[model samples]
Target: MSRPLTATINLAALRANYLLAKRLHGGKVLAIVKANAYGHGAARCAQALAEVADGFGVAAIEEAIQLREAGIRQPILLLEGWFEASELPLIERYDLWTAMHSLSQVADIEAATLSRPLTVWAKIDSGMHRLGIAPSDFPELHARLEATGKVGKIVAMTHFARADELDCDTTPRQSACFMAAIAGLKVETSLCNSGGILAWPDLHGDWGRAGVMLYGGTAADRQLPDWPQAVMNLDSRIMAVRELSAGEPIGYGGGFVTERPTRVGVVACGYADGYPRVVPSDTPVLIDGQRGRIIGRVSMDMLTVDLTEHPHAGVGTAVRLWGEGLPAAEIAASAGTIDYELFCNVKRARFEYQG
Candidate 1:
């Protein structure tokens, strides 16, 4: 069988990042493994961090159940909480925590009758306006949930809108609002995500949700004393190599015009495989452990790279799209995007988990 174009994940590195996040926050770490641990394979990553993470954070109730089925004993916080009222039973069965952001969720909890009271977190909408309850309604929301005998514990939390921008004052302002809204509640709090955990220490609370930072990506450009290793090395093989003459166009729509006699390497990966489709020619791709630039437009199943400077180019050679020696942020830049996009877009067909 042929080795498919795939990404190799470093499980050790993931654990290190989780440990670092915990150390930085000086509190419990909720390893945010949502979106398949940002495409690094949630089950694998969570299993590796089970001993270290105080808990896990996932977007859906099913993901929480998956961890439980996989033997993960740590508390799992549902980031989106229960989408439907019916999910409450499963959440309670798994002892997973839910983030009650809206009035409907409060009603669901009130209607629930589990053997054990449900652990709930109040998500305050300081500014993101994505989810969470309004600051003005925090008091009333808290009262309603507490009134329900099903409430086990309540945590006050909020999401940061500008956590990735170091200079953005919104993080601090949001923190103030969250604190004000939850005043006198006397419960544990959690407000920090990846960016907040790494850059804004003040945002750290009783618990922090560490995401991208635990995957070896820097948030807010803040440098850690010992950065975590890249967990995913996305690579493909060189299918063919060709020599081109000056003035000759390369790839579709003539996006690349050769400046001189040049060599092009065709790689076996494309947008269909989760490589960005918008990536223009001249995007950098590592060939044979050497830096090479894309020569033409990206296609659905393949893309070409300029290999004039690579002396050892040939068939079946390897190309590092990201991770390993190549940084994801750099690859994202070449494709006119961000590291988050590249990580999240990794298709299911390509994968090899190290953990």
Candidate 2:
């Protein structure tokens, strides 16, 4: 048959995670489905969450349009807003919500005439300087958008730069700035990302955007009482197994050399399949339900694992790259990256969705 590699998307777990976010925050949740639902397949994941989510968040207008085409009826927020004025029409046609982060975006929104007034999220750059107007400029911008009468409800929002760090003071400082900026405004507010939703309960407002955690990725310093279920199980199979003598080098560049008699299993997964090639030799992998350590530099199509501890594992032995019993966060940490990158980088595996 075809390659014994598959990326299984767990729809039931995805729904449960969304509901968990709702229960934890006790507010409307803008399910962050940007970057293809953090690479879990946006259309499928969004459809699964459509019934319960307050709304969905995407990185741009194109993603929102794609969801609309897929029959997703939930309100989709453009987290990064429109890139150009031309996208404003599509945003209006799709009935999408836009974030006004820059003065130029505000100008573009004001100049466009739409069939209905558009909902806007006035973004303030409390700490993250990547996108958003300064706190000092938020008042005038909000007033300007309101005066145009072309906008519907305007929600004040900001992104926390250090919500994941429990010891960091940046979140509190940014929250204070945002609070001061929108102190007397009549608009509702949102500031919590997944980390904020879990760690800083006070930051949850009219809306909380849940991203990585909804897919079973960790966001805080400590584990919570309610951990999200893993929504994607990346698996493969052992294609071959061999016995190696002491001092034998394995894989490319001799990155790993056997010190004693060892058994190795070649897994049908590698960097090309979105597995991190740079993962350290000690990174763990599961083969036939037994833990094994990667032994050498990962190749494009395959990688070798130390299977000496499990002599029963041979060709066709089940292998789990991440998810389910093995956490992606743990793998990512060993790879010098984050779970978000690992999820978004998956592109070469066959998909199997389960409810």
Candidate 3:
């Protein structure tokens, strides 16, 4: 038999989380399926939500093309726009919405020959200092895209830098800047990511990008008290159980030592399965539906969990690395990462999808 490791994608929970975003945001919501729906398998997740989602968001033209190939008929927006001039033709052929974040991208749009006008999302770098046109330059960008006569229905959008931080003023400041920049432009706008939707209802726009939250992730810790249901779980099993004395050292580098008699279960999951190797001792997991924790270095193929709390846990006992009962955010916090990274990095695990 294969290794007892699996990443179960919960499609019902996926739809629930998405509908929650749609209901809560009270506007058009684009399910961000970039990075293979954050590694939940884009095609399946997109199909599950195909009936309700306003559209989908991806990082580039390739991802959009993949969705189109998968028969995702809804609007697909390329969040990063085209990588080079050559991709413009593919963008047109796929009927994809492209984000115009740079003057060079504008030049490419102007010079391209197209079968029809394209939907454009005009990106404003109100904050985040990432891939977006400057607020000062947005007016010129809009004019140029319109002048080309190859663009139609420009949607103003911006990514929030600090929407996850409830106490931060950055979101409000950025929102004000974006609104001021787009004033009198008479274009629909998209400003909220998952964090923005959760925290600032007053700032909701014509369109919102539901990203991390769509796959059971979050606005992170601030909204942990009531984040939506997790859509995927990393499950594994104990391969072996070890009884050790108080002074025994565990795993690589002897970094963790037992202070008491310990019951350790070697889980069939490790860094190779996308569990973080740098996770310090006491990282959380679930054994036979009971709480457990990791206690040593994670090898490529296996890691040891403290099963002393559960006297009945042994080889073949079920284990959950994260999801459902055990949140991915908790494991990510222990590893000094985020749930997005944990989901995107999963590998070497059989997938089981359930509603």
Candidate 4:
């Protein structure tokens, strides 16, 4: 028999999430498929969302080109924009939209010779201090790009630094700065990410960039909309079962010691498969539809679960890592991380896609 480990990608769920973002924002959504659709397979996910999405956002030019080659007809935006002047021609050939984050990127566009004017998003660094021109520099940079005459329509945009934290005032402050920066400009604006779309209704504008939420992860402290569903169901099967008495140590470094007589079911999943090694023993997994706790340190290829209460479960019993009844958010919280890392780190598992 083949390995029982599999990461199932549900395209239907992905589409539903996209629609949820669209509905919530009441505007166009740029379905973010960067980092290989947060490791759900970009080509397939993009194809799944191509019909309804206003456009797609990717981290670099390569990602956009891949979608273009895949025959995705929707507009593809380079979220990070062109890295060098040489990429400008290819960006034009692919009919791609780009973000002008740095003055150097603007210069590249100005120097390039294109068959037609290109759509550009002037990214303002409201407070993230990571990318984009400073809020104070927006007017000067916008004027510079306009003088080039190569830009057809310029959209003002910024990324939120703390939209996920409802208690934080950073997002609101950033919005204020963004508004002030573009006060006199008539350009359309894009401000919301997944968190912004869900938490900051006032931040939604011409476009919403939906990322992790579209794959069934919560973006903020609030509850997820009912329409969004888990796009990835990561699961494996029990490979072995053993009985251990009290005081028996489990896994490397004797991380966990059996408190009583125990039935241990070894599952064919571990850190190498993207299950976080640091996840404590109390973390839960579903075995034979019964909740079980991981007993010790996760190994490279396997992890042991306490199955003392589920004697009926044995080899070949189904185990859910996270999905459906088990929310990834719960697992993420236990793992001292977030759902984004969990989704992106999945590796070596066979993938099955259902539309």
TM-score each candidate.
0.96, 0.98, 0.97, 0.98
What are the clashing pairs of model 4?
none
RMSD of 4: 1.1
Alpha-carbon local distance difference test for all models: 0.85, 0.90, 0.90, 0.91
Cα displacement (angstroms), candidate 1, residue 40, comes to 1.1
Better of 1 and 2 by lDDT: 2
- How far off is residue 78 in model 4, in Å? 1.0
For 176-289, candidate 2 gives per-residue lDDT tens digits of 999999877789899999999999998788899999999999888757656868999999999999899999999999979999999999999989989999997979998887
Q: Using alpha carbons, what is the TM-score of model 1?
A: 0.96
* Per-prediction backbone clash count: 0, 0, 0, 0
lDDT of 4 at 340: 94
Measured over all alpha carbons after superposition, the RMSD of each candidate to the real structure, in angstroms, is: 1.4, 1.0, 1.4, 1.1
Distance from true location, Cα of 255 in model 2, Å: 1.8
Tens digits of per-residue lDDT for model 3, 1-355: 9999999999988888888888879999999999999989998999899998999999987788888888999999999888898888898888888887887788888889998999999999998998798998888888888899999789999999989988889999999999999888879999999998888899999998999999888673445444579999899999999999999999999999999999999999889788899999988889998888899899999999998889988899999999989988889888888889999999999998898
C-alpha lDDT of residue 344 in model 2: 96
- Can you rank all candidates by lDDT, best first? 4, 2, 3, 1
lDDT of 4 by residue, 67-146 (tens): 99899989999998877789889989999998888776777877788989999988999999998898888888888888
After superposition, the stretches of candidate 1 with alpha carbons farther than 4 Å from their true spots are none
